[model samples]
Target: MSVITQPTDLLRQQDPQMADVLAGERQRQGSTLQLIAAENFTSGAVLAALGSALANKYAEGYPGARHHGGCEYADLAERMAVERATALFGAEHANVQPHSGSSAVLAAYAALLRPGDTVLAMGLPFGGHLTHGSPANFSGRWFDFVGYGVDAATGLIDYRQVQELAHAHRPKAIVCGSISYPRHPEYSAFREIADEVGAYLIADAAHPIGLVAGGAAPSPVPYADIVCATTHKVLRGPRGGMILCGSEFAERVDRAVFPFTQGGAQMHTIAAKAVAFGEAATPAFATYAHRVVANARTLAEALEERGFAITTGGTDTHLITADPAPLGLDGPTARGMLAAAGIVLDTCALPYGDGRGIRLGTAAVTTQGMGEAQMAEIAGLFAGALRGDAAKTRTDVAELTREFPPYGA
Candidate 1:
């Protein structure tokens, strides 16, 4: 019998059907541009760690106090992940165990508030994530979540309204950060409101953790009592979640994560996260984070020049939300048209309940080594695709993708 050293080769020989699907996915990613605000490409090193032999372990508890034995290596991996995460975000403590962003949010709520307690967060339709307060999600099902939205005219958060709501409700927690708002949160302002109401402040930095870690955006650790983030998004790690908090709430957070929310942690993903955090702490990542924002600004400006309506006039982060009605299209229609043309993004409901809006991000493109010039070109493709010239636009998209291949091919 031959030794199956390479997993891919073994899969090809034993399960050709699944292998084909994986190959197809690789081709698709390489051929198309990924503009999803919550998506990015992890480095090859991160991928290697994710597929390491650590996946076979079963470390059920914290590093030192495990439920099972034979966990020395698992303990090392978890400790390294925690240390790197705390160092990267400047947190007093960090938990890299929750399975996803939703789990992290749930654990935070469980540790901080009672099931029926009132919590304040952004509305789902107004650039906020489903996990924030959507009725369909677990967060809204358990807690009384009052939502706030951006101002209609300025398309910005109304700090006065947030403060007023906090005063009236006196919520147990106030959640900041958004998935599609395009502007950074005023953590200091939220902290002040939380202080006045005697509420804990939770900042969900899932979308901008890389920017925050790289020093391109303001850190929320100073203002937020607890911060929850997904490691996969801008952090460019394996798909996992993390919780960062001060020493006061560290034990509560750890208990909430283990035995309460998740069972044994995904050690392989934690290993990958450790690698990613190390990469994010470097000076090169700071440059990439700044470039991500610069590219987004260029893309927004280029789209505006083409008669598109950009929310808030432009962007301050790596994302841009645009009203597609100018092109005689709704959000879903625009999304479909762009998908057919090989450009990928998301369709979102407009804040004021108008028609719909389309969201684009620069993180994945920037990771692929795209710059301002590429952003301009991508905007032109969007215009052409929405203007009933998808064929030509698709050709141009293919050409451009070839120039900036995913993960450098």
Candidate 2:
């Protein structure tokens, strides 16, 4: 775990002020909880790769070809990242150079659609990412977007309604993924709908790509024409994005990610992604992935017992979304209370109402070696944080986190 401290140690000599900030962040992570659905701790090996020599490179193209000289090491890193990603996800090709998940989605759009081409995606109110056509992003400005949503009663995708919309609008592409849905997407159903309407199926598997790599979740590679994901989240790599597809769209995808959308590759993050893909292929990561789901399910049930309305009844993935209104609190008020009590998480749009709900995940806690029992403990903490004295709840959270340090015990 020297990987966690060595950089800070060196920075403390030349730049004590910035060193103090890093130290504060480290202490905050160690002393509090991380329930955010889109966050996780990267392994030390991955961190080392991120800080390696490749960070200085400026490679601007795919392997065996570049727009800059002295890209020998940079090309090597990208090739390894591409190969490992293709193997890990069972795709024919991978572009690991997009700076973030949103960028990957942009490249996917660039590869397949023209300006004004209609696109169908989950509505932002029901857990969709902003790239799915938020008015604030490029996708909304350039393309005509139609939104689909979950059933208000069941809190799940309404496939029949999606089919009706797809046929009516005949969009050029359909996107399947969400930021806080808490369940596995039916990729086969999406593929069927897309095929019936002559639309390309795009799977934004950012949140579940790690589970897919570990064999804990179904693969979207076999079903979607294009798959977009992040190298972080449950994948536990440095923050970056990648695109996967069959060879048929491989060239178009690569070109879109390079000159059309992004600049030089982030060689360091790509190297770190290679390390994570290697780790995820191991037996240990598979166990960890399944345990993430187990902890999420247990936490969801426990929260329901304590007066939160669990979305979709429970979770089949690491994510869980719940309403705190049953406890006489709204999402923002509940979040402020939890933050005061040192339990970190995010607020999400609810399926049934105009109000927001709390969203959480078990990846970080599972990485800290917690299990189902600890998940129940966390739910108890949530209740106390929302309904009891803030100082007492904060103390209990600190005590619990001390028992399981993120880097080590």
Candidate 3:
């Protein structure tokens, strides 16, 4: 056996049960299409970092100020992550400690607003994340959140309404980001509105941060007071959260992430994030990022041609949210049919329609070396799957996946 398979072999020797489950998951991932909008496969180097010995270490607080002893290596890992993150996103300061995207958003709110303060964010039903203002979330329970919606006709952000809300509510902060909206948010317009209302601009860039790193999308670092993002998604990093800000807000953001919201930093994940940040800065990553967008546009167009209602008419990034109502399938039904055909994706709210829609992205498929031709074929597969042709569609999907295995044979 080679180094790649040695770990599984060792695990099987000691813990056969977990080893089997892990092996099954690996098989499932390679066999099925990973079209989830928030998912991507990280490089082997990043995975190696995650499995490093740092996972056993317990390092609390920031680098050089750790509350525990024997943290010299931990400090080095965290410093590398912070430096790489700042350079990749062109931010003055970066915090790579938040456990997930929601944690990052929590830190941003903690640093900027007090409990019960007014905040303006996209409404939950209009594709906003739970951290934005879902009543069940800490954000909505703690703060007074005013929700914004998209233009009913265009399925686009209603900037005019946002401005009016900002002026009327006098919110302490304004959040500009979403889970299903496919277009880039106009950061400048958001800045103008926040400035007009004397509110801080907090950009929850969990989705587009990867494209920003690859130069495929506009960055919010310049316009927002604080930016919260996930390290994965289109960024192709490990699962982790990151916060970027100007030097003025750096300390507050860091403190909020450290003592206020979270405790010890996961040194292994931080190391993995550093490796991912380094990878994302390369020329190849930029090409990959742009290709992700190209593939998404192609897929969106192909799906539209197949009778699905493409949201916002199309996509500007890796994500595409489309209503499958034309095919007599709602989002959940479409998702079930796709799963039967070995295709995987998520269901999301349709801003301009009556029911839910399916949300997917090209990041993983593009990473697997798929191109425009493959995207068109996938659309055909989607149509066939929704028509209840599960066996044939699953067989074709397996054949296509075999040609472009996520990891080489």
Candidate 1 Cα lDDT to native: 0.88
User: What TM-score goes with each of the models?
Assistant: 0.97, 0.98, 0.98
Which regions of candidate 3 deviate over 4 angstroms?
1-7
lDDT of every model, 2 decimals = 0.88, 0.91, 0.94
- Tell me the RMSD of model 1 versus the true structure: 3.0
Question: For residues 241-319, could you state the per-residue lDDT of candidate 3 as single tens digits?
Answer: 9999999999999899989999999999999999999999999999999999999999999999999999999999999
lDDT of 2 by residue, 1-409 (tens): 3336634567899999888888888899889999998999999899899889888988898888899999888888788888999988889999999999999999999999999999999999988889999999998899998999999889999999999999999999999999988889999999999999999999999999988988888999999999999989898888999999999999999999989998998888899999998898889999899999889999999999999999999999999999988899989989999999999999999986769999999999999888989988998998888876789989998998899889885
lDDT of 1 by residue, 1-409 (tens): 0112223888999999998888888777778889998898888888888889999988899989999999999999999999999998999999999999989998999899888899989988787788777889888788999998899998899999999999999999999988888888999999999999999999999988888987888999999999999998777888989999999999999999988888998889899999999999989888989999999999999998887789988998888999878778888999999998989999776788678788889988898899999998998899888888988998898888888876654
CA deviation > 4 Å runs, candidate 1 = 1-7
Worst 10 residues of 3 by lDDT: 1-10
TM-score: model 3 vs. ground truth: 0.98
lDDT of 1 at 87: 90
Off by over 4 Å in 2: 1-3
Better of 1 and 2 by lDDT: 2
Clashes of 3: 0
